[model samples]
Target chain A: MKTITSTVMLASLFAVSANTSAATLDEVVGKGHVQCGVSQGLPGFSNFDDKGNWSGVDVDICRAIAAAIFNDSEAVKYTPLSSKERFTALQSGEIDVLSRNTTWTATRDTALGLNFAGVNYYDGQGFMVRKDLGVNSALELDGAAICTQTGTTTELNVADYFRSNDMAYTVVAYEKSDEVVAAYDSGRCDVYTTDQSGLYAQRIKLKDVSAHKVLPEVISKEPLGPVVRQGDDQWFNLVKWSLYCMINAEEMGITSQNIKSKMNGKDPAVKRLLGEEGAFGENLGVSPTWCGNIVAQVGNYGESFARHLSVDPLNISRGVNELWSKGGIQYAPPIR
Target chain B: MAKEESAGPPEVTTKPWNDPKVRSIFFQVVLLILVVLAGMYIFGNTADNLERQGIATGFSFFGTTAGFGIITHLIEYNEASSYGRAFAVGLLNTLLVAFCGIIAATILGVVIGISRLSKNWMVSRMAMVYIETFRNIPLLLQIFFWYFAVLRALPQPKNSVNFLDSIFINSRGIYMPSAIYEDGFSLVLWALGIAVVAVVVMTRWAHKRQDQTGQQFHTIYYSIALLIGLPLLAFTVTGFPLSWEIPALKGFNFAGGTVIIPEFVALWLSLSIYTASFIAEIVRAGIQAVSHGQTEAAHALGIKAGPTLQLVILPQALRVIIPPLSSQFLNLTKNSSLATAIAYPELVSVFTGTVLNQTGQAVEIISVTMAVYLSISLGISAMMNWYNAKMALVER
Candidate 1:
């Protein structure tokens, strides 16, 4: 009896320990696909199309990382998560990477046991109001009822904005983004607040699409990017540099269409980026042409922006999202 | 003979390992050790994982600022409060909704349950329809129906529908008159407490009188009068210490009166209505479990149908009712966690959802949230146990 009980106990303990191991670069590759956490549905950020294809800025980041690892963008799985479950999913090894539109906060960096890869989209918190309300600025929203998604930095930012301005407003919060829009569209709230890009993408879903205007005042900095669990430097560097390579490709005018032709350029920066002159890809534990794979599969950051947000569907201008060499704040460190 | 018995004890029947009693003891000791080892392994693994991930693993996050606003709170709260304060607000809101839901469900359940068993065809069929309609539908869908479909269809605050001169209805919420307590309100409240104690003593005396003299006092009427009369008398003596602040539409919302947010209304209504359907069935089963001969015997005496139910049937039926009713209460409290879906800011939505995100202490925050629900369930069971003891069919 004693031996039987001891054996059972040992077996159960092993069962638990087997599942508690954290994410590692080797584990992701061995699994044959990357597990990426994303939102349930957020237009132009990380949402599925009518044909069940994932296409958004955040989704592209996941694809780029997949391309870097497997050289096939389709070698990826998506786990749609709420804001509440996003971090836990990464921390518990349920996902290899959380490519959700998560902001990189100081506390999240130092305390959350997570590392943000890099900023794929630089957004600021802003408010959207009906044009009929005659509110063009957030300061004019003194007594307005606001709607926002819960479990987000936008909720706290709106609270701080109202308190600092001594405004008295009620908030009607919801868990899903569509619910927030539904509430606002139904006149349950006078204002809707989120990241500025979110405002631009979500405005089209309103009852009268052209009747709403985003307020002029940007409240707080919200640098949205992908995130991963801490303690895996190899995985962290792989995801971070994957995003950086996209930005670098854009800055160097290397489109997926032109990447193969540009690989023969004499510029040392271009040569090193394409893995012709250096072991940068080897340093990150991928194939020598990993940058080329990402570029060829998912295109550069500028292309993703144009395809998802800046073109026909969501015509959000690239104000602060442009590269530093241009007039915007998007700057990536040099490869060499 | 005694020497034989002692010598037989010394002679082992079998090896100690194979002996039944010895082996039982050995197995129990092994089980205890195994449980301890398993618990330690889990704890150590969790600690190691938390340390490696850089996530803080403690309750210290409760002391920091919450930096968020709740839609409704029973207690005072603000963005400046700590996460601890936010948790308290959430708990209070949960308790408020749970208590209200239980009271409403009990009243509705008993009424429908007694009516379901009615001999009248129309009454029974209507009760069955109500029960099946609510019980068959999913609760989350019912909540969404109330919130998104029913309440959101109301006109905006600027064009609110007036219920009366004192109350207003709008898309924001239902607004009504607010009661304001003045300086002498505590005196009236004390008078009401005194009246309650007096009524209890009077009830015991009346029971003894009936036992001895075979005569009944009008106790129900007497108790009601005493409970209401004393408070009103005190109010008159203290110069009417109650006032009203009637709701009127101001610039944006009705500012000075009490407002019930749409989330609370939807959650409370859906929970009470859905749980009432199940509770109605429980009530009917309890009534059916009692032998009909008991009621026939009461009717054969001088008792009417109303007195028969009040004096004989309900007391016997309570033994079956209390246990299941307690379970339903626990279910309601746990289901209150669904408040997160509608943004009600109950304990789960506020503490586990928002605070967990802000602090990034999923391990600690989740542990605390689970403990809260566990304690609530245990507390309800403890109270039910006491009631069950009182209702037990005691005999010598």
Candidate 2:
């Protein structure tokens, strides 16, 4: 009986897949909205307001993509997904693009049959302990109980760190970041470990924010970026180059307010990038003013970074995220 | 009847193979075939799409090195380990939580369930309040509350709350004494094994003698005697083998003992409390299902209230209760999947979420997880059904 039911289910799934294969791109374009996957809630990364308006660093990328395609930033729908559901949603075409704080790994890129457009943030796993514990360094946490989120790369890093250091520590694993923070705060865990950026975000939420300090040791590299499903080359190019345009704009000193003036500038590379010459957008099946539309609608990479995640109020520095010319890792290919 | 039979035989109207019933079956078979064909066609297209994109399909990745990390696990794991081993660790962690939660829930649930029906008003009200409070709220919220609001408020390890000079509680986790084994531990284990075997044999002998001689033997007392006697003899023969490793404060945190993380405590406590409410309802219904007259009848037969309940009411009530009770148990098992929300490293969190993403084997990993859950549910149901059949009233 179970087999029979499963067979029926399999049949239904096939019918849906066949129906979807005809023209997925047309369907997305015709609908006038790109369904972009995002994180549930990560304050400055991807969070929704009480009015249901979505805004974040990742949110701006989705908006930028939409602007490049439809010439309107609002022509996008956000699908907030947990870490577990994000891939499946992308695989099933529930979302046109995934702009969540997803890490770019070989297994995810090749094994999951997905393509990462480009790296947006170069992050690493780190530990956060209460200041009163007097543990100034990750090495000082030899026998400490660590609160960690399960189903993440952070989990394995914790185990590896402890084992390599020849220190025995108990692990209090949770599924969500919030719970990991809660457990750590409740005196259930000696330390809370995750991405350094996440540690900064969560530390502020502690009852006594002054009491906790994020340790200096970075255990592993986590290059987080946007992604799209494999097999759609045109759509992939459109998203990939959109991010490149932002980075290039930042490098070439292009801002939203000065993009029009910069279009008539002397530099041939800048002219080609600002769509003053050549037809690069036509190759990606977009209008000639696609890059112009993206910059105008969502601002350049620096603007987006400052507006959402700068060191002003959120206090997030552009340490590794700064442009390559500025001693950072964000280098983009030439528009020409 | 003769006229009808003659007419039908003449026309061969009752052709069993061509009858409407048979045709209906045939139609269903054809429909099933069409459906299966359509399904296969879609699956083939997807495979082709994946192939064109150079994406390898199948479970072969399970044998590959994970090259990934995990936060907490009972067994040893490394980035160099096979995905299969990582999966095993995930399964073990899930089973560990489920096993612990089941025992805790059962004990707490039975106590609360009985209390709801107690004569003491405050006790019943308290149980009622507990049921209403925990059952209505979502499990995820409770986990967050426990982890963030409750556990995160703990004192630092240096100022950990000490109790009885053996246990320590702080933001890190609860530290408790673990039993250490000495040279005599082997003798103590053997003695315990012998005691268990002796008790079983004595109970069988007592039952047989009672049947043969029409004389009742206090089997419980005899069994208890054998169980204790063998163990005591062994302990006397060999010096006590077990020692205690009382947890003590080291440089900062408690060292040399077992630690129970607050995440585990929160998950376990929340699950037990939430599930106990439903279990209480089942217990109440099971008790109510039994006829009240059976108690009176048992009383007439010289059975006391406790014995009457044990002998007459419970056996029958259990028949109705077992089916639903099994479902509740299955519910608890499935609900444990929510442990992922709190980073419990259950099957869903480890295998499906992390491993699948790390390996990019969504289809294979999800299928494996679904199969594991299906088998667990089926296994529990099968066990319950067997017990039900054995205890069913036999009527001639």
Candidate 3:
């Protein structure tokens, strides 16, 4: 043992830990795929179906990113992460972009060495209570026991809301979202609290869909969006504009079906956005047709919103999620 | 002396490996170098990685306000408390669960261990069944079953099952009447302390007198009386200063009483019951290690069955039991980390999960948590080792 150890020690003296730079865009292209981090499962956001196929609003962001880079929506891999592991995974460069429904908080963006590209879904914390409880608003939830998963923005949001409102509440926090749902379903707690969109999505999993009501009050702003690691500005811009391109396209009457017709349009904003007028994509280190690929492959923001969230299974109304042109806050910069 | 000189001179033609002194010195030097190098490399690696990431690699976060509310804490805590205080609350809660679990398990274990060796057929078989049922199943599942399935099946606050109008049981938790000590309670505590000291002095005198005069005294009965009677007397003299604050049903949960949260109950119950199974096995083996001949010999010497078992068999059996029993205690303490699974807000659940996520200081938080658990395990073993030494047999 002594001889073997000495030999290994002698050998390790010459070994080196080679350092690699954080060039996420080049790395993704070199690997021929974009590694995207997403939530474990949140319907209309990052849910996995029975066939192991991933879909939702967050998944569309990942696909748009892949199309922007590789011109193919399928050139992407999904890594499901929990709330606790999402930040570390991004920081360690294990995934290019965290496309989970992570809230863009000041601490997360600045302190945690992360950068929130842009808001994909504007939301806020809301409460879901049993209709039989007759709690119409959060003010009526005094002395209530709230059920929420720990280690997320929802827990802290509800905590802050209750403290500020001078209401006493007992929080029954579970580690898993499903556990929180089960606990709430089992009547272990009186109210279930999470993001407004999440409450709508998770309400479908409850025991009785019609028996619970989501209160109208939004207690905290939770601008859920994709996250990228800090110090990678080029990669940040790619992720930021990928979502922006979709939003701007939605404002420009663009959709996945009509993207081909608008490819050679005469409009300057339309031409520049579709790569016919300028070298914007070249400046961002991708091809000139990056926005076009994103629009053609992943659809516009409104299409994704209606498909995954608003009109279908999730049925979440686009409240703050609607385009700014339509009185919502989802405004993106013009392609010019 | 002559034979030794001859043997030494004859072994002059020796190899380095053949010499015990040289081999040990060489191995020690190699191991020391390896250990130091490994430690330095790890520290350097961590420092480098932290610096590169621009993370504040210090313990300054401990002093900052945590800005979070913990649901279960022994110490007074709020959102305004420092991170260090939050950590203290978590540590205290962990110790609370572990301490209660150890005491309960020890009592339950000894009873069941002895019952397993009972003369009646049903008692022994029942003990066997219990041990098998608990030890084979996973503890995490047991905690969840008790917490989610069984405990949640109880009634709500308005419909709570009341026990004599002092306690309330519901899905939320079990609320019992808490003692509200009024002023002048310290006098009662002083009386209890004095009574304990007197009992100790009496036990010593009894032991010495038995040694010198060969006469036995009712030391156990006297001690029990002094312990209970003095406390009661002090209470009566003080005009029942301790008042019972009965639980009252409020809007959602019962207020005013000391409500043990269902998470605490589930974690405590699961840990105690699960650990008691292993403890029962250890205790049974310890008793079995004491040969049957010892008990038979004591019986033949005119000692009663209870005294024979207690004085003769138990002392000997304990020597075999202490080592494994101490390990089981440590195991129970470490298993308290499973509190995270059921969200009891113990050390790991609160500190490692919430604090780490909030501060985004994974490296510092994880190492500190590890150090805490390590110290707890080491501390338990040290105390038990001292106990084992005390219980050890004296020999010339």
Q: Candidate 1: which pairs clash?
A: A113-B53
Cα-based lDDT at residue A242, candidate 1: 94
- Worst 10-residue lDDT window for candidate 3 chain B reads B48-57
User: What is the C-alpha lDDT profile of model 3 across B304-326, one tens digit per residue?
Assistant: 98998789988998999899999
Q: Please give, for residues A122-188, the per-residue lDDT of candidate 2 as tens digits.
A: 8899999878778888888876777776557777778788778877676666655665676677676
Q: Given candidate 3, what's the lDDT at residue A216?
A: 95
> Which window of 10 residues has the lowest lDDT sum in candidate 2 chain A?
A1-10
Docking class of 1: acceptable
User: For residue B38, what is the lDDT in candidate 2?
Assistant: 85
lDDT of 1 by residue, A218-312 (tens): 99999999998777788899999999999999999999899878878899998988888899988898998888899999999999999899876
Alpha-carbon error at A274 in model 3, in Å?
A: 2.9
Off by over 4 Å in 1: A1-23, B1-19
Q: RMSDs, each prediction? A: 4.5, 4.1, 4.7
In candidate 2 the C-alpha lDDT for residue B247 amounts to 80
Which DockQ values do the candidates obtain, in the order shown? 0.41, 0.42, 0.33
Name the runs in model 2 displaced over 4 angstroms.
A1-25, A160-165, A263-266, B1-17, B24-28, B31-46, B67-80, B107-135, B141-156, B160-164, B180-184, B205-217, B244-252
Q: How good is the docking of model 3, by CAPRI class?
A: acceptable
State, as a TM-score between 0 and 1, how close model 3 is to the true structure.
0.92
Sliding window of 10 residues with minimal summed lDDT for model 1 chain A: A1-10
Worst 10 residues of 1 chain B by lDDT: B1-10
